[model samples]
Target: MKVVIFSTCVVDLEFPNVGKAMVEVLERFGCDCYLPSDQICCGQPTYNSGYEKGTQRTFRNQVDALLSVESDYIVGPAGSCVAMLREYPELLKDDPEYLGKARILAAKTYEFSQFLWRILGVENAGAELNGKATYHRSCHMTRLLGEAESPYALLEHVKGLEMVPLANAHDCCGFGGTFSAKEPEISKQMVDEKVRHIEETGAEILVSCDPGCLMNIGGRFNRLGKPIKIMHLAEVLNSNVDERRITYLKQMPV
Candidate 1:
């Protein structure tokens, strides 16, 4: 399948490796991937902050960039950003020029893990990581994108990896984009609680599908002098891959 990669701002600015890993994994699955040079932020940072009017141009720009090349799918590493991309249809519904384009863009977009499990029918990527780790479910991914299982399903197949249950895994890490910036003290307390729960799991590494949450919780860990390692789901899934063990579902599910 031909895939267009939607590189989010966080991945482009802070977690370039996660984007690279995502591309590697997709290519491994025989996807012809294209990264649009014109792609930019999905406007979640401003839109979520109640700047919907100002975010329209950003939404249009992203649509134009992703559609610049015809592809079967538009995949992204971060669920939060992917969710934002999926909202373009509704966000621009009233725009006569962009509404139809927005719908087409939204229809083909998928978060990295979601595409692997749902579209590619991949059960295992043959990754091996020997360490205790717990996953943080980002609010946007779980609630907005409605993808609560794809990450866990893929993670279950990673050899030598121990997945621990995170306490209150559904709780937000307080990185609601500008929310963390606007309410620093509140954000700190929320992330502190998140870190405390992560510590309770006794996991050596923290994993999450959303970079913002990882940045929030990981930053809290750093400020508190915690030694826990942080990793994005793409990075974890791309580790020590064994080609011989890679397997896909016998049939793609509806």
Candidate 2:
């Protein structure tokens, strides 16, 4: 499949590895992924903060960068950015020109898991890594885009993955983009709960669909003392399966 990747500003700058991992996985899945050099922010922050007019200039540029490619879809590694683009049309209801573009972009825009499971129509992609994992259902993905099963469906077919359910899974990690800044104490409280759930699962890798949530919770895990390693969903799926096919002798739990 030919597609263009919409790398969010956060992933482009701070979490470049996430973007790189996304491309690697798509390539492995037989996709021709293209990146637009001029792509910038998805205007999420400003738009979410009731500054729709302020977001127009950036949104206009985003639409242009995405339309520059003649591909089947515009895929984004970050669920938040994809959801933002999908929501743009409603926010731009007053302007038909931009609204039309936003609707077109929304039609073609899809989150990673969405594209993999829906468009590609293959779950259990030929990846086998033997280990227990817990998936963090990102808020933007679950609440905004209503994409709940895509992540789980992908994990079900991972070469040797055992998905452990997260406790209180629907609760937010408190990292609603700038919401953490607006409410630090509450955000930290939510992170505490999320980390606590990861510990309960007894999983080595705590996987999440969004980098932003991982940033908040992972930072907290780094602060105190935690052994659990955090991984973006793309990174987990991008794992090199060459060595993972080997099974290790299990030690009986006492």
Candidate 3:
């Protein structure tokens, strides 16, 4: 299958390695992956802020870029942006032309974990990272996209990963794009509570699919200088086991 990688803006700018990790994991699984250079924002910011006209630039930009790729699928490590693309037709309700095109793009979009665990049927995707970890279920993945189990399914294969239940894992991390800017105090408070949940998990790694949540949670962890590690889902999937396991695996590549 030919899959195009849509590295969301946050992942592209802050956690670029997540994008690389995604490409690596996909390639490891034997898919023909293409990264289109001209691809820009998915227009979530403008669309979210009630600026349909403002989004025309980015929305139009994305359509133009991907339309040239000739790929059968477009995937991203984010749920929010995909959800935005999926629901953006409402923003273009008056414009039948753009709404039709938006619907076409939305139908083909897939969140990375969803693609890996469901569409790709990679129950035990051959990636193994040993650690106690807690997953922060981003709002987009849970509420918006309604894709709840893919991450757990993918994580089920990580060599020795202990999946601890996060208390209120369904809650928002408060990195709501413009939400953070307009209400900084509320956003900070939400993240503070989220950090407590991570601590409660006693997990060495705090993993999430969205970089916005990662950034918010990671920021607090850093400020507290907690021994916790914040990481993207792609990072976890690309992760191989430690030195001892690699030596053992090469002796018998599972």
Candidate 4:
């Protein structure tokens, strides 16, 4: 199957490797993936900030970029961006010119995990990771996009990987884009609490799909000198199976 990848701003800017990993995973599954250069932000930040009118230009450009590419699916690693992309239909519902285009794009767009497990019926992408890890059910990916089980479904198949339940798994990571910047004190408190819960899991690594959430929690881990490793879900899914076997043998507890 051919696919057009929507490299979300966070993965494009802060974690380019996440984008690369996503491409690797998709290709491993026999997907012909294309990353269009014209794609821009899905206009999530401005729209979420209550500036729907201000988001029009970016929204239109992204809609065009996404629809112009002929592919079976338009998938992205970030659930937050996918959630926003799926919203374009509603955002342009009243505009007769763009409404049809928006709906077309939304119909084909999907989050990476959702695309892998739900759409493709993939149990595993042959990933290997041997470690106790906890998944942060990212707010946009879970509550907003209503994809709570897909990531876990994919993770469960990783050889030698133990998945732990995060304490208060449903709580927001406090990285609601501008929310963290606008309310520093509250954001800090919320992230701190989140990190504390991650620590409670006793997992060696924290895995999540949204780069924004990883950035928020990873930033606190750095400042507080915490030892938990933050990993993108894509990276883990695309891990080398040989190295994973080695890790499983060496790291498995007696």
The sequence of per-residue lDDT tens digits that candidate 1 reaches over residues 80-194 is 8898888888899899999999989999999999999999999999899999999999998999999998899899999999999998988888898999999999998889899
- Candidate 1: C-alpha lDDT: 0.92
TM-score of 4: 0.93
The 10-residue segment with the lowest total lDDT in model 2: 245-254
After superposing candidate 4, which stretches have Cα over 4 Å from the reference?
A: 242-254
User: What is candidate 3's local distance difference test score?
Assistant: 0.80
Count of backbone clashes for each model?
0, 3, 1, 0
Each candidate structure's TM-score, on Cα atoms with residue i matched to residue i, is 0.98, 0.90, 0.90, 0.93
Residue pairs clashing, model 3? 128-159
Q: Is candidate 1 or candidate 2 better by lDDT?
A: 1
Worst 10-residue lDDT window, candidate 3: 245-254
Local distance difference test scores for all models = 0.92, 0.82, 0.80, 0.87
- TM-score for candidate 1, residues paired by index: 0.98
Encode model 2's per-residue lDDT on 60-173: one tens digit a residue: 889888978888889997787788889877867887787887888889999998787787765555566678889889888888888898888777767777889999999998
Pairs that collide in candidate 2 are: 124-157, 127-159, 128-159
